[model samples]
Target: MKPPQLTPAALAQIRTLGSVLRVSLEPGGGCGTAYAFALAAQPGDLTHDLGSVTLALSPEVARVLTGARLDYGARLKPPRFRVLAHPNTPHRCACNRSFGVPFPGRVTPECRAYQPMLWNLPECP
Candidate 1:
């Protein structure tokens, strides 16, 4: 399969992650050798210190993730990332365990509590 295209925004975020985290596509064990995108975080790394998001796709699903865009937003109710699939492509859970549902475009502020704070950076001292 061809390499997946990364959006400018996604590329910027991925680059900001530095070498602390890696995003790659690997072979899946189930459903006809699917493509899986993993967000592997290194121990004590701040790249994913906040939280990590993974996206695994079956061969059937890769088509859906290709050229897709992921954006982060803030909301008052509940917090979550917004995954926008290309037109005509159905969205699925990153785990491949279930179908994805439409979530709010803005993530709730409450979710920020779960993320590690930049203030905790050891270099702050």
Candidate 2:
């Protein structure tokens, strides 16, 4: 898979600052998945070198983030990292904090088993 696409500004920010960036799959509302960006890297994470900066992602998130784009929003009040939807994934949840993984798409086991009846979501086939 192609490495994640980072805007030039984001690329420079991390490389110049020598920052460690981590992306992970967090448990979301209704047992969905949410993307999280942080400065801490956890054990068992897979790392990718982006020039002087390192990008770490958990195994579950790595599967979903391939081919996704990461851009820095410097204009936002506090500035933030943004990610576009991966090609194979569809719409996000109604709350906008979680995402739906279509059939055949990979998801963490927690998502498949988390209070399934409450969300009216079917278990993976």
The prediction achieving the highest lDDT against the true structure is 2
Taking the tens digit of each residue's C-alpha lDDT, what string does model 2 give over 1-125?
45577877777766655577788765555436667888868897788887678888876667677788777778866777767546534556554446664322444444433322112222322
Candidate 2 stretches with Cα past 4 Å from truth are 16-18, 29-31, 94-97, 102-125
Candidate 2 lDDT score at position 56: 86
Give the per-residue lDDT digits (tens) of candidate 1, residues 2-108: 32344445544544554222332232322212223334543332222323333333333334345655542335134323344443223333443222221123222
lDDT accuracy of residue 46 in candidate 1: 25
| CA lDDT of each prediction against the hidden true structure | 0.33, 0.63
Q: What TM-score, over all chains together, does every model reach?
A: 0.30, 0.67
Clashes of 1: 3
